[model samples]
Target chain A: MQVTLKILRFDPEKDKKAHFKSYEIEADPLDRILDALNTVKWYKDGTLTFRRSCAHGVCGSDAMRINGRNRLACKELVGDIGKKITIEPMLGFRILKDLVVDMEPFFEKYRSIKPYLINYEDPPATERFQSAEDREIFDETTKCILCGACSGSCPPFWSNSEFIGPAAIVNAHRFIFDSRDQGSDERIAVLSQSEGVFRCRTVYNCTDACPREIPVTKAIEQIKRVMLYNR
Target chain B: MYRGQSGMWLWVFHRLTGVGILAFLFLHVADTYLVGLGPEYYNELVFLYKLWVFRLAEWLLVGAVLYHAINGIRVVLMDFWESGVERHTQLVFGTLGLFLLLWLPAGIFMLKDVKWFA
Candidate 1:
């Protein structure tokens, strides 16, 4: 099948504004969008740039707006997307180049939530033990790959860059609900601020756009409930 | 345009209807305040509202308010119930269905007395 990949391209050194560049390539229906992108960069145009690692969707590096939705290129099959695909970098981020956005701000928000577990108690004899039920509470959030798909799809994050996005909240939820972790107080304080979980308008875009299938909006809502009742 | 699904459309509609309702509230407050200015000013404003254009706008306002109120309930449901998140798409469709159920009859009745294209 001949697929036309309409990619939003920008070259800081030359182009004054971003523009779409189309490339027609022969591909199998079962071929992943990442494969098509690889064909374009390797054969059609060497200047075509995108980020991809472990092109099996594990690394979460190749997330972009595919056909006006945030999706990992590696996971979306060309068969599902039809012949013509309009690809653009994720929204709510600075476009550093073609198909790449500056993720520094995103990571800073992730850092602000203190994503890692915080336990000041003495170390266990071997390791911290947790029952299966306790693990299940945050099991869904642990699948987050930080692909930025959910956060980028969010309208509030698009309108206000400072809004600590769904990704950060999901990361926070991971630690906040853990039975072994003891940082919920501090994390809740950070998330209860103006730019925090309240900024979410229950749009559910984050839940829809998650490549990992994380229930993002639900997690944020759960955080809201925790803050409300626990306080 | 982000080709988002039912959830996105609901959010967009909710926001637009909310803004529309707020604008109507401002207009309503100003019009109600006209009573203090005397019966003449208030009656004049009321007469203007009886015009066909304003009557049609009133129908739209009714629909907007209905949809916004119904969808607001959906948001509240989703916020409080875990199952609401799982069934949000259904809830959105249900909200729209309920809005249509209530708004259709109200709109028809509101516009029945208006003379259009006469």
Candidate 2:
């Protein structure tokens, strides 16, 4: 099948503003968007730049706006989208080049949430153990690949850069809900700020944009509930 | 991100209706309180509501209320139910369908007494 890929092109060094460039490529109906992009880079134009490490959905490197929805290009099939596909760099980020966004702000937000587990207790000789039920509580949020799809899809995050964002909240929830983690109070303090969970209007865009299919809205609400009752 | 999907538009509409209803509520309260002052004052206040402009707003308020009530249900379902999140786009359309079904009749009934529509 033939598909028209209209990609948004930008180069800070050369171009003053971003513009759309279209490419017509032939591919199978079941081919992933990453495959089509690769074909465009190789056969059509070598200047077409995008990041894809795994060429699969796991690495989450190829997250971009495909047809107005944030998705992992490697995971989305060409046939699932229509004959015309409009690809653009993820919104709410500086565009480094065509389809490659500067993810520093996103990562900064992720790091601000203190994503790592904080346990100050003396080390156990064996291992820090957790029951199956306890582990199950926050298991879903651990699937985040730092793709920024959820954060990029959020409207509030776009309007207000300070909003802690869904990705940060999801990361916080990962540790907060962990029965073994003792950093709940500190994380709660960070999240209790004006830019935290309160900014989320529960639009469900984050949940929809998540390639991991993680229940992002539910996790955010869980954090809100925890804040209400626990703190 | 500014131009969002169905879920984002639903959130925007919900908020807009909420603010509209709130503004209307304050006006409604002030108008209702006039009844306690005296019959003459209350009757004059009631006369303003019968004006064509206010009548038009009354129709709009009914539409706004119906939309807010239906979409509010959608928001609650999305928050509490796992299935609602997955089917959120469908739920938005469902809310709109319910809104139109109720609003069309309620709007006609409310505006039936208006001279312009009559």
Candidate 3:
């Protein structure tokens, strides 16, 4: 019938610091979390602010800390949350407002690893084609949508943000195992740097938070083993 | 090492400290190689090396080494020792405590002597 939502809100100027604000919402058992929040902002408080490019969890712009874990707001159901639902901005990022975190640092690390494929030669007149087996290796990695969920869930990134997190490494894996890419050695060399792949402790938090169900820890370890043998 | 687990964090810390040790090793070796760069460079190098910053770095280095060594033993025990399997987590904490025990006195001595080059 009714669920109490405790959301963390911070207005840099007005509040001067972060605090949790609670709101009551009445909705059906099947309503998505976004629907509940929308109901709250529409009728109760118009000052509530959060980012959502897609209400269906496709764009991943609604990733936040839901009940002490990193997840997309649109994906969580209000009925499923135990007791009280706690919403906060994603960890390990600069909170812009209520439930919104600046993801520039996460994107910077993604760009630092040269997330694009390093194709040595051009494709034919038509397009580049590959066997099913070859595509399978990188298929899971490509499912990542650059969401900051994994990086925020990582403990190492909490200590030192420079540690190229699992999200970036997973992006790199999409290219590292690409059959057309000729930069395996180059990517491995770059990753072997101090804060590169070696910084990963194989914590597997990335794998746990990945909504795409990609085998992130396995992919990172594969890159690690490549660096090891290649050296 | 997945979420809601213990050894996962420990393993991560161990490898991180391992990398820290490797970087320290490279820097230390490169600095020590200056001894062969003739006496004038060596004297200047030693003079600069014997500073408060260097002493602080030494303290951090000792901490890293102690962490790695103790964790490595935990790993080794996990690999060996018949009764160690059931007691693995306890062994990890025990050795980690041992490391702290050893590091505190070693650190005190280093600060008391106050000799960076020595």
Task: Say which candidate scores most in TM-score.
Answer: 1
Backbone clash pairs for candidate 2 read: none
Model 1 stretches astray by more than 4 angstroms: B36-38
Report lDDT per candidate. 0.93, 0.87, 0.78
Q: Which 10 consecutive positions of candidate 3 chain B have the poorest summed lDDT? A: B77-86
Assess candidate 3 and give its TM-score to the true structure: 0.69
Better of 1 and 2 by TM-score: 1
Report the TM-score of chain B alone for all candidates.
0.94, 0.90, 0.83
Q: lDDT per residue, candidate 1, A66-174, as tens digits? A: 9999999999999999999999999999999999999999999999999998999998999899999999999999999999999999999999989999999999999
Reference contact recovery of candidate 3:
0.09
Clashing pairs in 1: none
DockQ of all candidates, in order?
A: 0.68, 0.34, 0.07
lDDT tens readout by residue for model 2, B13-61: 8889889999999998998899899989989988977877888898789
Residue A176, candidate 3: Cα error in Å is 0.2
Question: lDDT of candidate 2?
Answer: 0.87
Q: Which 10-residue span in candidate 1 chain A carries the lowest summed lDDT?
A: A222-231
Query: Judged by lDDT relative to the true structure, which candidate is superior, 1 or 2?
Result: 1
TM-score of each: 0.96, 0.84, 0.69
Residue B10 accuracy (lDDT) in model 1: 89
The candidate that wins on DockQ is 1
